[model samples]
Target: MEETNLYYKLGGQKAIRAVVEEFYRRMLEDELVNEAFRGIDMDRLRNHQTAFLSYALGGPVEYDGRTLREGHKGLNITSEQYERMIRIMNDTLRTFNVADEDRVKIEAFLRSVKPFVVGQ
Candidate 1:
């Protein structure tokens, strides 16, 4: 039997966009997380995030953006901030009613990218 990727399991691009929007909203609302986004272009970031997440979730889209480390470089993101971001992402997934198994997979993906995102 063929395995269904998380992209389709979570409904696809539209669904991913919704999750990204909600995730950003929550992030911006949080003072600590919001600082990282200061001076950044939110609209562009949102678009890139949507595409990145779609690709990460196994959608057919290609993400040609900067590597995670490069993108987050000089941000000085701390471990506490990273953990908060993870919590926010997980909460966003839960808000969208994503399956537990799928959330676990996504969490793993996030953890895998931590080295590239934090303390850059």
Candidate 2:
């Protein structure tokens, strides 16, 4: 049987890196979301995100980054901004041709973390 893990299905580290790169590109281009990333270390953030995504997708990697609330704390992210971020992520996944079922699962995972990420 084909591997059912989302990490494997999405082509592991390489594919997750590609998605994160594209996702950050879109986010940085977006006026609404770009401010949150201002002055942050892109390389470090990218690495953390890659690891985080891998773990989120059930990969072998463990995420050692800050907790969602702690990382986003003091950012004062608005609900609209949070929603926009989700849309961008959905768009990024679609651009990568992720299956609908997989996208749904991913979206659900993201949404499940909304409280921790939004009101930080």
Q: Give TM per candidate.
A: 0.96, 0.95
Per-residue lDDT tens digits of candidate 2, residues 1-120?
Answer: 236899999999999999999999999999999999989999999999999999889889877778999999999898899899989999999999999999889889988998998867
Clashing pairs in 2: none
lDDT of 1 by residue, 1-116 (tens): 11499989988899999999999999999988899999999999999999999888888998899999999999999988999999999999999999999999999999999999
**TM-score of structure candidate 1:** 0.96
Error of 1 at 64 (Å): 0.8
Estimate every model's Cα lDDT from 0 to 1: 0.92, 0.92
lDDT of 1 at 43: 93
Clashes of each: 0, 0
| Worst 10 contiguous positions by lDDT, candidate 2 | 1-10
